[model samples]
Target: MQGPHPVAPPLVALTKRAMGGMRSVGGRLACLFGIVAALGACAVGPDFTRPEAPVPGSWQNAGDPRVSTQAAADSRWWKAFEDTSLDRLVELAYHQNLPLQVAGLRIVEARAQLGIASGMQYPQMQVAFGNANAVGLSENIAKIGGLPRNYFGYQVGLDAAWELDFWGKYKRGVQAEAAEMLATIADYYSAIVSLSAEIARTYVMIRTFEVLIDQANENVALQEKALEIAESRFRNGATSELDPTQAATLLESTRATIPRRQTALQQARNALSTLLGQSPDTIEPLLVGPKAIPKAPVTVAIDVPAAILRRRPDIRSAELYAAAQCARIGVAKADLYPSFSLAGTIGLDASTRGTASANLFSSGSMFYLAGPRINWAFLNYGRITNAVRVQDARFQQLLVGYRNTVLKAAQEVDDALVGFLNAQAAAAFEQNAVTSAQRSVELAISGYREGAVDYQRVLDAQRSLLQQQNDLTESSSSIATSLIALYKALGGGWELRQNDPVVPERTQNEMKERTDWDDMLGPSRPQEPKKNAAPAKH
Candidate 1:
């Protein structure tokens, strides 16, 4: 065992309870000397409070029944499209995206940190043991030197240290870390939402490109037929050589685009595949088309500000971080005051300080020291005070950051609405154009067969028809992308993911250890979307 620790904190002014009760320096030290035997209990710290959310009441273009369920963003938003391939892709990314996996590990780290922080409020106990052997001078000669000649001994003991929380600083730190862990959890949810959205967007684009390629091929075929007819007519002296040359030139020009579109289509496929964490070649086939693109717009609900508060992970994370900062401020503030502690050591030992070096466990003369201690920070005037101020400043910064995040979320909803409405209009217009262009091509073919128009006129109509068809394809894809944007903006798809909940790397041991602290961590929020996940009224 050991005596109470000896030290005083800087700048810590002492009042000694009252003028008459003023303790002598020796008295204060004496009380501190046996503090371990004198004290018991946990410390002081402020509990954390989750900040009130400031979300908007309604989205700009929220169309139908809004999802009111919890954490829906973790699930696929594209289930509304009924596209199996898209669902598969989202699943793949959720499982394989490296960033998301890293984010999951981050959550684990936060949870572990929370555990460590919480532990600060508990009584800490430690055990130590030692042994020694030696040979030296005799007792008579050593007696003249006031020392023993030789010695041998061993010792083992336990020690405890507990800072009395008259101020609760450690508890505040625990609260702060808990909030930080919650924030990390939200980050993981956001990653899942992002992964699903990316896969859907890329899948739609790839499908659109496939449709455009088909149109390009048809255009080339029609142009070649027209060029052949023009040449035949010129050879028969029915048309000028100039007309035939122009027709042939247009045919080659239209044909040239096929290669370029093919390249772009391929590239899009590769990019999407990589995002899904697969080899480029692994996704080329998915681009070959017959993709089930979304045609029916999924109606979104207007849950207003509260929905954003509940649905957006970034917003939630920011709130949690803010809460953490608030708790930290309390922690820093607590540091400015003097600390009281209950500490002691019970051990078997012999003096190692003198010539009797080997009698550490001298059963006949075993030496042990034990006591409680009080530490007063009586000197460094500004250090503790400045630490508190620094934490205060940091906390203020987070408050600003949290407000900004909510503001940005509002902006995103507005932007998505504009895009969604425009995409709808464009799709409708492009569909009409394709129908009109197809009719024009049919009319031109009929006239060319009846000799009412030259073959070049038929070629022109066919070319325009092909372009309009490709345009229709592109418009549809854009509309699907817009829908995806809307879903993300609406903050849908946060549901709990499943399988064997992989205990986070940092927590696996603690989980197995079954500490008394386990129950104090609070129940984990339900991790999976309920079977009744869909909008109930709808």
Candidate 2:
């Protein structure tokens, strides 16, 4: 559907540009033809072939008990967390992130390149009309030379040039360009997935650090109280100075961690800001602490390994890159043979001359012409051979890249499962330790004040208790962070986005003018817009 506006800028510019281009050839119709000489009109080079996907039916040694997965890999797993803040953050990133924005621009670039490549298959024609003055030069020049030049000559004609795709070289180029466009699209998907993961991870870490800092502050207060009690007992000769001094040192240690934790929090936020394509300052307010963790959902499907390809954007990007390389190789191979092409031009021109050297166009001249042409490169066969080799090497390199992407995807899922599981167990253990230590601290301080126990015991109990409190908080953060990693490793979000990036209304209208030259001799007709399939991402 078109937007509710008249003559958007994109359309206006495209219209002007197309008109300029069409007018350049005296607005003539040029006959376009090709020889495709390779007896088969087939490209002399190897045809593009997709490399086999390394599809593993199942993950190796897979037995991480599936936690409650609320959504499948190809679903928006973040929604499972039930964090409205997280959902908002991801949506914002998709719309405004700079890297994502750049990826969109790349799509435009790829389209322009495709257009250029497609042009190679067509013949080029041009026309010109001008009037030139003639000097006094004719068969009777001596008699006429004595008489000054009298008139001007006018001339007009058509010029045409075309190269055939006999070897299919140009066709291969178009194929490669088309493949490249697909690769760029995959790249856009990959960027979106990566940004979502970074944002989620950073957000989790921010909350975790907040919890850690809060616990540290609380522990320091408890330690201060313990130190004061120990000092009192030492003055009364009920405890040694060693006990009071140790308690003070312990308190200082906990206090020292504060600045470092603060710095780390800032850094994670800064990193996240850049990923969102903003300055750190821009993100500070947008991503403050205390973001609610999504409700843990109980049963997301843990898919088979083969499904990962369909779920992960990086994997798809890699595969498409490989395909692009394969197509380019076909383009290179097609260079080894000859090509045939045809072209024609029809236009009118009239000119006038002042001097009479010999005028031809003065009476109104115009012409029509058409023909076929051939381009053969047998002597440069070695060069073509080298080009084919180079493309082969590139194809091999991209193939390896694809395999590595798959391997890494598998490894990440495994790693996330392990970390998440361990974090759960560790959190449980730390919770127990905190309860026991807190109880022990209370008893030890009471005993020291009553002169029933040395202050040393009080100091020891205070230290252990504070450590436990800090550890417990850290454990919570760990579990949450691990969960974030697992969700990302499995590829989160994007799949849930129901629409493609909205193109500027003007640009959509503009694209129409570029697609045709009004089909003048045969009235212009508009074709239905194509439907694009957003690639699947788990």
Candidate 3:
């Protein structure tokens, strides 16, 4: 190892002298800290209280056996579809969704902001400095004959200033930032809930299109055989040419539907690819398994309507936003009062004049300044009061917004429940229609082959069968998709985050390479409850 620096001894001695000076004022400093601490105990503005909002005691569909008031067991509600591919897609999206990653980065940014606010409780300004100067005295101003005409001066020292939190300005600032950080965390979970629902919805659409396309192809093959039989009869003088022409027209129309369904399938796949944060070409590999609409569970545990206050991330975020604004009112109010601070400067200074030279670090050259300061903006007409009013107004706005969010959440759950029940009923009727249409087509074909009925009967039965089959497919998809909507409306899927990191490890590694995050990028710190604030239920 390299030897110590040549100037280390003198630096150590200088530090010791500075420490000695600090000890001399330690008694007064302690007294000042005690006074400031007592003052900091009481903040200037109103404390935050959770806002109350109206909610129904139970959902409109609660009486149905398919809906339950019991607490939801799975936050990963998509798994109820019993589709391994959907489960895998949800897992992949949790790790790779671009919007979700953005939401996580916002939490990191908010954490840094909280750190900055917390730091304000300590010394506001601290600086170490050194200077050397050459000075010349004017002959006209120097009346003493022994006075030197020129001199050299040097200085090196430290200075600091701390603005006491007499009005709890810094404390309220910390509270605001802490609430904002929690809001960002809620936003991240909200992103998770949205991403999961959107992926499932898109996957259902893809499967719906696949089933419809298959039905259209099957109709086209059946219609082509019908066209061939009509032409054979017309050639043998048993049927008119109009029958063959009509059969060809029906076959072409059925073939036309395939391209439209294919287009929709491709679009759904591309959308899914975006949600997975991958290119469209890569989506095909993940979609290699069976292309069937996921089955929805018969019953969903939606809990009571009041549970939305705690279960919905957006609702929690809205409440946190109001809490953050409530703290800001205090921060703004604090500025109206006079600020008290302690400012001090200590240093070693020396000068060479006449025939004498003094060492810069000598006790004779030591200098210090210490004092308390007060600043009051008494002359600002009505600006400070108006600023406080502005913050209070904003807090009120957020309170109302939080209430509206609660009402909207309840509305969403109600709408989804109605849709799920109605779609299930419609699917039942469509299934019956498809079964009857299939039987009618078989009878019509048999009558035409035995020369007992006209070819138009065959065409009518075939068209009815195709229409009913497509209707049943659409209705079945609606049943599953409606359940997805209900799950999303109830704010399911965010609990998956309890076992996972908000920010991915790969992203954390990349951020570490760019900056020293220390423990900030590690596991999140436990939140400290604010005095007089309601505890948030996660």
Top of the candidates by lDDT: 3
Error of 3 at 258 (Å): 1.5
Minimum summed lDDT over a 10-residue window in model 1 is located at: 529-538
Encode model 3's per-residue lDDT on 337-446: one tens digit a residue. 99988888877888887568988877777787887888999888999999999999999999999999999999999999999998898999999999999999889888
| Among all candidates shown, the one with the greatest TM-score | 3
Q: In model 3, which regions exceed 4 Å deviation?
A: 1-33, 135-150, 525-538
Candidate 2: residue 405 lDDT (0-100): 87
Candidate 3 TM-score, C-alpha based? 0.92
lDDT of 1 by residue, 1-538 (tens): 3677443221011111221232453476565545533442333333334444466666545443333332333245588777767777877776667677667667666767776876777775555544554556554563545544554445545567777665666666666777777777778778777777788888887777767777777777876776777677788887789766887777788778878888987888887877876788777555443644556454443346566776788887887787777777777777766777766554555545465454433433333344455677768678978887887788778778888888888887778666767767787898898888878977886776566887677767877887788777777787788778867766666564533233343454565576533432332446321221111121
| Model 2 TM-score (2 dp) | 0.78
Q: Write the per-residue lDDT of candidate 2 for residues 281-368, one digit (tens) a residue.
A: 8876775446443334433356677667777877777766666677677778766666565566533333233243433322223344
Error of 2 at 40 (Å): 7.4
Model 2, residue 363: distance off in Å is: 7.1
Lowest lDDT sum, 10 consecutive residues, model 3, at 528-537
Candidate 1, lDDT over the whole model: 0.64
The superposed Cα distance between candidate 1 and the true structure at residue 232, in angstroms, equals 2.4
